[model samples]
Target: MTTQKALIVGASGGIGQNLVQYLSEQEAWKIVGLSRSQPPLKSTAQFIAVDLLKRDDVVTKLEKLTDITHIFYTAFYGGPTFSVPVAENLAMLTNVVEAIEPVAPLLERIVLIQGGKVYGRQIGPFKTPAKGFAEK
Candidate 1:
């Protein structure tokens, strides 16, 4: 049987580290961790330190990671402000997806883990109609 590989972005962070530990415990998965720094947890996961802010760097480093079955994106870029820039964050996310999609043919799913306060809640009611789930 072929080994299932999972990539955990921002593997050094709280959420990402836990994911690395959990996925590492599962015998079915081969975990590859990507972050700006190494995770503090003791894990068998293959860790790759890459700056997500730099699109070219991310592409260069992740391009060789073929046969990825899953991607858990927990990375965030706050830039120089107290809050992260929307455009920068969007660009980072887009860059990673574009870099990996072409090389990883076996890729099946990508999970983006949402953390911290829901800033969207401050934006007031949705301008568009809800597409999924009923609002309480």
Candidate 2:
């Protein structure tokens, strides 16, 4: 059977840490985790310290990963006032995508982890709880 490799960005975050733990338990996945902070010592996933804001650093580090198959993006930057900075947030995600795309030819899937902010619940106009999300 072919090996499945997963690259989890923001691997030190709450969701990212859980995902790394879950995927690591599956024997098929070769996990590669990236984040600015160091992962917990108990983490089995291979962790690489990286800052998405540094484009050159991101490229330098991620370019060496050639066999990645799946990407889980959970990185986020929460500014003050609970308002999501759309441009800054998009830039962070874009940096990862741009850096990885050129290096990961075997990449098959990309999963972006969005939250309630996308639905304008906690970041923008207050809408009915049931209201579906719309682009700002």
Candidate 3:
């Protein structure tokens, strides 16, 4: 049986941390976590300290992980203004993808994790339940 390897970016955040814990319990699954700080919990997963903002650093750190089967991208960078965070977050995701694509030939999927902010909750309040399409 082939083992599934998961590379989780932003492994220290709430969602990322939870994922690490969950994946660690599954059989035939290997976990590799990347974050600026170490996650609080102890697990079998290997952790790598990486600054997603630095392209060179990300490339240098992640180039050798050739066995990764899936990439769970949960990293986020916040700023005083909205635009700054948007650009920086995109750059972070790009760095991870560019670095891993060439080295990890077995790569199958890249999962992007997004939260409630997509509904503009950060800006202000909206309806009780959000809908995919706007009401006419």
User: How much lDDT does each candidate structure score?
Assistant: 0.81, 0.83, 0.88
Off by over 4 Å in 1: 118-136
Q: Which pairs, if any, clash in model 2? A: none
| Clash pairs, model 1 backbone | none
- lDDT tens string, model 1, 73-121? 9886655645547787778788888889999999999999855422332
lDDT of 3 by residue, 33-134 (tens): 999989888888999999999999999999989999999998878667543366787899999999999999999999999665645566767796764222
lDDT at position 91, candidate 1: 83
- On the 0 to 100 scale, the lDDT of residue 94 in model 2 is 91
Q: Rank candidates by lDDT, best first.
A: 3, 2, 1
TM-score of predicted structure 3: 0.88
What TM-score fits each model?
0.81, 0.85, 0.88
Q: Which sections of candidate 3 miss by over 4 Å?
A: 82-84, 128-136
For model 3, state the Cα shift of residue 58 in Å: 0.1
* Candidate 2 residue spans exceeding 4 A from truth: 117-136
Candidate 3, residue 3: the lDDT equals 94
* Residue-by-residue lDDT tens digits, candidate 2, 1-136: 6889999998888788889999888888999999897788475688889878888988898998899999999887776866667777788889888988888899999999855555656655665554534443
